[model samples]
Target chain A: MSEKLKRFASNNKQLLIMIGVIAVVFIILSLTVPSFATIRNLTNLLQMIAPIAVMACGATYVLVIGGMDISNPSVMAASAVFGVYCMTTLGVNLVLGTIIIILTGAFLGLINGFAIAKLKMVPMVVTLSMMTIGTGLATILSGTRGLPRLPDSFSEFFNKTAVIIILLAVMLIMDFILTRTKFGRKLYYIGNNARTTKVSGIDSESIIMLTYVISGVCAGIAGVINTASIGTARANMGPQSQILDIISAAVIGGVSTSGGSGRVRDAVLGAFLVCGLTNVMNLLNVSDYYTTLIKGGIIIGAMGIASFRQQQAAKKGV
Target chain B: MKRILAIVLALVMVFALVACGQQAAPAGGSNQSTSQQGSAGSPKQDIAEAAPAEKPAETELKHVKMGLAMQSLQAAAFHAWADYLAYRLDYEAEQRGYEVELVTLNADNDVTKQATDIRDLIAQGCEVIFCPCLDSQAILSSVKEVHDAGLIYVSYCREVSHDAQGDEVPDLTVNFASEEQAYAGMVDLFNIMKEDGVEPVKLIDCYGDKTDENAHNREHGLRRAMEEFGYADLPVVEVECGHWEPDVCGQNLAPVLAANPDANCMYSSSDFLNSGIQKAMEDAGMWHKHGEEGHVYFSASDMYPLGIQHLREGYMDTAVDQGCYNFAVHAAAGAFDLLEGKEVEPVQLVLGTQATYKDIEEILATIPLWGNDYADY
Candidate 1:
């Protein structure tokens, strides 16, 4: 049993280091900030982190397959505005609105996938253009104004325990797929070398496209959750800052931006750390200007440590 | 799969075109109706006959094309203000036996876009232009070009400065005195705090977007009030920048409350920021009425509907209405004055109204509340 434990620890050394960093930050915050240790504060932190964490989970998949999606926030805004429009303007049921939101997101993702995977366009440019298109469409669809408040039932459903349970279930399923499925294995291979994976009859393009679809679906879910929480859906609901926050959380949690090396659990851990740091700073009454500086420093520091780890591993021929 | 993708893309394009066509159809119909009226009775002739003795003979009120370049319609307040302004312009024009063609362009909070919008309005032969500029400095050159084209430029809500010192101003300026409104609300809250026997009221100052001129002015106004109330040197527990975002406001405010649990009073830059602060306070069990222990006295600017509702619920102590309706009306009136070659007086108008819980009902009855007409939209 001791040998097995050692093997597991060695296999997840980077994750363990990340966990250590999170523990150190949490312990220090709890000690220094009197209100940080409260159950209420922790619950509030969790609630705030939910949408970003869910988005990061999908982003982790895209990153693992060597792709970048800068359009998640725009896609989220579009889905949210469309969803609210369906429920309020069209007087549709909650279930139908949700389906429409998810499908809208998937369609947006399909656009990115087709352009990047099939047409050989640069992922950055294609996603950036899609972001502009998505934002414009959201603005146009909402008639350049925020949608009216949604029904109480819709928001209540999102705030219930069921929503959190579903989010956890999604994370668990994604983790299982990455760890155990052939599809997941192919993602790593494609990230490592797409040409070799394609030569091996693994259909790399299809897998890459599927990853974007998953990302888009995740963005859709996040949009709904956020709009519900806010009680209104505006065209500019999710700003570009949200996308930056998600990417930073994923990277800090141990997800490789270069792709093919992260777990869903790692992304969650990152989200917790990021959210916890902000919560603690708020509890301590840190100025927002300083908060921004601290957040940037931490992200850069984490990225530095990650790069250092990669270099050491390369030198050791691992 | 590629063929299917192509077909889907084609369908999306077709749908977008149809949507655009539908939106334009109504405007086309309205234009047609206006032209028909013009041909039938010659509204310009009627306007010339009805003109006062001092009215310029050449200034016969015809179809005056006025343009307004708005910052963005994302915010409910801006949307409501723009809608009211358009309605007022149409009404005023009809009353004078003339037609008003108002073209409104949303800059979406982009300074460059605002400049481009103003240029386009000029090219479209807009006789007079009104802009609540996104950036005063960035839009100065565009304003210069409008002036060069012999078009009147009116500024509202924010002042457009030609120089760094703001020595050169627009043709007409409609000021809302946002800072004075914020200061007045704070002063009222302080008075309430004093009546409650609280000393040296601990304040949590939540300012709006730092980049905004109104935000800076409001912050200055708040400081002035603090000084007047002899709380200028009093230790402020926390100062947060909400950036006018509700979510950011709530997230940043929670920790401030956690750190300074005894903080009693808050001065918010706007009602929108107050909404987030109220939510955070509620979650922390700190939201209480005036007489309750641990009650948080709050004051804010912008008497939006949500703020009024909060006032009714005893959550918000006071709010200042920025007089958005009057501001828009005055802007349109100023443009009309310029077009008719009339002498415009009081180049700058500072309008605001203060509302407390005691007078919320009266305020609601008299004022047009933002988001009250969501169903109409």
Candidate 2:
């Protein structure tokens, strides 16, 4: 039993650490804050983390390819605005509005991937430019105007608890695709060594481009959820700061910055971890400054631990 | 990587510690603007305008479509303004004997998007456009385009310049002098402190987005008030919190808190800033403790849901509630006038500029803590 435990500990070190930290945080906060342990609060916490969690899922794909996708918030803002515009002004129904918006995000992400993979632009520069371009297009398409009042039926559909359930279902589907599909295999291979994968006859450009397209679709999904959650598609509803939060969740969940390693399961766990932390902070009335300080520390500490473990594993010839 | 992280953490900690040691004073010139101009101008009679049913003689009803380009509606207070204006216009358009179509454009805080939204609105057959701009130049370019198209374009709440033809071609009407709102906020804060009999009080004056003309005007108003209130001798340092972001406020004010143990009062340009200040103080446990009767005071303009609740709960002392409902009503009125070809001048509708204190119990009693409870998208 002891040998089995040791094996588990070494192999699942990052997961163990995340669970331990979360458990400790929960215990401390629950003891101190009356509202921390409530089911109602937990439910609300899940709702609040919904948008960021969805974005983090997409970001995990980008990071797996040894590239960063920091444009989700911009994509979300743009999607929400454009979605609402198509609904209200262009006289489209909600489903069509949603599809058009998602397609727009996919197209934007495809262009970004083409720039990065085909043109050999830095991922940072490419994604950053995409962020600006997407935001500009959203605002222009929205005509700087929000769908001030959504139809009552639309609002009702968005406000239902079923929305979150549906999103979780989407996450499950994404997880299956990442873990079980050929496309997923290609992603892992490319991230591990692009040159080797290319020599093996994998279309690296197509894989990279398709990943971005998927990232864009995920952002669109997040935007739709945001519209429902906030009950308005106000442009820039999720600002630049939200991007940092999404990245934090992805990293904290066990997605490596170096790429070729991570689990879709980790993204889910990371979302819970971040959402839980924010909930506890709110309950405890922690100042915004301290919250940010702690958040940054956690991200760095997680990366450090992961890197250190990797180094130790190499030294041990594991 | 660890060394880099450590250095960054240390720098942040140093900044935090240094901030706690400094004292905050009222912004420069807080007392000067209102005491000079507010007193200099004769008090306009508080006579109410004609009630909603009666149309003025020769009132023309032209079905006109108007557009307002917004930078973003993330700020709840501004969102309220947009929602209120749209709701009121829709509610009252029939009563005013006109068909009106109101369009709002969210620029997502992008300057280029703001310019493009303006052009799109113009293309949508909007005769006049009201803009709370993201970028002054971007909005101005749209103004030039709309003017060149011979559309009656005007900037409201935020000001924009006229073309070479001035107000002739575009037929623009600029309203809501932002400077007045700032002056009013500062004067109210000063009077609140005076009424509390708090003297020699140190304060942190938080301002927002210095690049924004409205925010700058608010800062200027507070500076004007300091000179008039004899609080000019107090030490005041300025920090700009970006467009009412709570996190930015916390970042800037955290340093200020570590430096100034004697900070009993804080003045913010926007209610959004007040919420941040409250969060900072609460975190530091400065709230409801210490400094001459043990209450840290805060005041700001544009009372939002949180701000209104804070004021009611004794966390905040005074503020200027930019009558959003009135803003909507007046915008409708202005739009009607423009449609009717009524000669409209440069008019600033300064609504709900009254200073509220705990003593004015009746007035406080009437102030709705939360209105329009249903979320307006």
Candidate 3:
């Protein structure tokens, strides 16, 4: 048993370090902050982390392929707005509306993918343009208004419990695709060296395109879940800050911004840490300015530690 | 298969950590009221029956926790109001000899974040919560949660949906007559422009984001003023929408200025956006000071610091202040009143003020503008 534990630790040294950091934060917040240790707080923090996690999880695939997607939040808002507008205004069924949301995100993702792969466009530029287009398309689709009064049954069925279940399923799917699939293995190869990966008989373009498609599907799921949770649909639900927050979650989870080294598991942990810190800070009555600074410090701290670990591993010739 | 097992193990370990960290609330009592009455009836009526007839003894002063959840601190108007509220809360707490802990949270303009912020406030054991909500309709579900937790909810500035009983969800609301502030500003602008021997020929309407209900209200105010002042037929060269971003406002204005060189007058929904509009106009060479050859008649709502400086310098013609300072005063009052179980108004209107370039000195000296507090900005 001791040897098995040691092997597990060696294999997941980075994840274990993150777990340790989270555990420390949890203990300190519980000890110092009022109402931070309660079941309600924990549950609330866990429930809200799902929307962020879904996007961050999908983002892990693209990050592993050495690509950036700043368009996830915009995709979420656009898809949710379109889906809800169809249901509320056009008298479409709720389930159909939900499907439409995901498909719309996928469609937009296809556009982004085709441009980046077939047209040989830069991922950052293509996604940034998609981001602007998505936000604009959402505003036009919703007629620059918020659609409210969702069916009670729809919202009622998609409450807090649904958040956890949805996130769990998404994490499982992403983990399977990343760790258990042949295509998933190729993403890392492409990230490490695209020319080498292409020469090695991998359809690197298709693999990259597929990664974006997965990202879009995740954003769609995030949209439906968020709209249902709030019971309202506006064009810009979470807006640009949410995109940055999603990226921050991935980076904090130790997902390499330059690509090729991360997991959905790590991103999930990062999501929890980000959400938990926000929840605790709100409860502790910290000012928003300080909260912003502290959040920056955590991201920087996480990246700095990861860099140090990489340097140490390199020195040891690992 | 081993990877699947490892994934399962990781999840279990995480859940175990969550279970290990779970603990109980502190010894202090939560602020959830036992009485789950309607908002209109709950605070004002209950306070009448329940509050002490007079001030309690110094030692008997009640300790209360409160929360102020803002949409964002991006806008100068929000910053001014929040700052003034923070200051006034301390002053009132000292005067009333009560202990008050106010936690101010900014949602960064995200409805999802704002909803979570509201939930966090509820979790923090706050008795009274003040929010100028992002989307009033969207926040209804969280409003239900707030009441379910039996806390007093006070909405600031904007009106929200009513409860099942047809009463508003907010236990109390400090509301502004949304259309009136911009209408007053427009009216003042038109009348003062006529006095100065300037007629609004071709006009431009720079407005706020369409997603905001308040922005639509400002649009209605501007149009109503146009119809009433006999300028409805005046051809508007451009109607630019700035999503409350200064750079967006400036960029939107630049092309419109170039496209319509004949445009002579402008109305902005929010004066906070005028800096961008100002820069855009300067780029177009149409930003000449008042009494100069190419000065445009400018009118806007909200007395932010930039508006104050422009009106003083004769670059801007008119501004209607949202009375954010007074709004803060009333909102702070309603917060403490609800906490102390004192009778509070169900809905109170905070009136707006109009300032013209001609009266900048007098108005700045005589009136309390939230912008005055941020003159250095």
> Pick by TM-score: which candidate is best?
3
lDDT string for model 2 (A200-299, tens) is 9999998898888888887887777666553446555656766777887777677767677676656766777765554544343333335556556655
DockQ-best of 2 and 3? 3
- Best DockQ among the predictions, by candidate number: 3
Which one wins on lDDT?
A: 3
What C-alpha RMSD separates each model from the true structure?
23.0, 19.4, 7.5
Worst 10 residues of 2 chain B by lDDT: B38-47
In order, what DockQ does each candidate have? 0.02, 0.03, 0.31
Model 3 chain A lowest lDDT segment of ten: A301-310
Residue-level lDDT tens digits of model 1 in A121-173: 99899889989988888777765223556655776787636557656877888
Per residue, candidate 3 scores C-alpha lDDT tens digits across A1-318 of 999999999888668866876776676667766598887787788777988999999899889889989899999999898898889999999999999999988888888888888899999999999899888888787674567568767777888788789999999888888878887789888877889999999998888888898899989999988887778677758587787678878876777777777888888888887776677667766667667876666556555655565566558975
Indicate the TM-score of model 1.
Answer: 0.51
The fraction of reference A/B contacts recovered in model 2 reads 0.01
Candidate 2 per-residue C-alpha lDDT over B38-119 given as tens digits, one digit per residue, 9 for 90 to 100: 1111111101122455763335754767677777777765565565555555444545666666656565564534554565
Q: Write down the worst ten-residue block by lDDT for model 1 chain B.
A: B27-36
Please report the TM-score between candidate 3 and the true structure. 0.86
TM-score of each: 0.51, 0.51, 0.86
lDDT at position B166, candidate 1: 31
Residue pairs of candidate 1 with colliding backbone atoms = A282-B255, A283-B255
Full candidate order by TM-score, most accurate first: 3, 1, 2
True contacts kept of each: 0.00, 0.01, 0.47
List model 1 lDDT by residue over B206-291, tens digit each.
Answer: 76765466777788888999999888787675455534787778888888888888787887888867668878898889999766
